[model samples]
Target: MSHHDNKPPKVCIVCGMPLKDKNDYPGGDTSLDWCKYCGTKDGIHPYKKLLEGMAKFLQQTQGMSEEESKKAAKQMVDSSPAVKMGKVKVAE
Candidate 1:
């Protein structure tokens, strides 16, 4: 088998979330590179879509203001593996 077959679960490149279960993957597709929130059956969502989702998650979970959540989300997105590796692009 390929070495990749034994690799451990990957953290979501877009949101830094751990993909530790089948439910964590898009359509339960463990073969996908990103997590469920970052994609769907159609494949990875757009950068803006990911940013909004992360920002909303931050706001709801951390009780941060909308601006604060958005700022944090932007930072996470800019430094994310997908962004750094050029798998995903940021518009600005």
Candidate 2:
């Protein structure tokens, strides 16, 4: 298969370590290059859609209020192991 057709090799942006399946880099936006750990440390993800959907799902599935759902989503994103290590920063 061509390089484009093959799955991108996962690499930790922080330490440049080869990531395992359990530590698969979150794939959503190209702009956010940092891995999960680093992303969390920086506080933001390339794809807000995934985070928003996760928040909505939590709210609907758990019968949480809008605010609560939002909070839950934020927490999930904040606590992500990848975010903590990836340290991705959104450009201004």
Candidate 3:
């Protein structure tokens, strides 16, 4: 069996961010599958909103061009655990 078989995933399902603390979760709910940036107490953000936020963060942190950051964000979200598990969907 996998090491994490019975444990919560160590990474956010939506953005693939490392979940290191309760503060990293939405409303400090450690049982959440997504991160603070990817969701709220209500639910996960819509796909476009999630992508835009991630792209902006990538551009700011990585010094990437707007187009490049958007591309990277889309790729990251598309391959995220949430998407793979059908918890989140990305349209091509």
Cα RMSDs, all models = 3.2, 9.1, 4.4
Tell me the tens digit of each residue's lDDT in model 3 across 70-89.
99999998888888888776
Clashes of 2: 14
Each candidate: what lDDT? 0.86, 0.53, 0.85
After superposing candidate 2 on the true structure, give the runs of residues whose Cα lies further than 4 Å from its correct spot: 1-47, 87-92
Question: How much is the lDDT of residue 59 in candidate 1?
Answer: 96
RMSD of 1: 3.2
- Residue 50, model 2, lDDT: 39
Candidate 3 regions with alpha-carbon error over 4 angstroms: 1-9
Candidate 1 lDDT, 1-92, residue by residue in tens: 34565777688878878887778998888787789988886767888998899999999999999999999998999899898989778987
Indicate whether candidate 2 or candidate 3 has the larger lDDT: 3
The segments of candidate 1 whose C-alpha lies over 4 angstroms from its true place after superposition are: 1-8
Error of 1 at 10 (Å): 1.8
- Candidate achieving higher lDDT, 1 or 2: 1
Q: Give candidate 2's TM-score.
A: 0.43
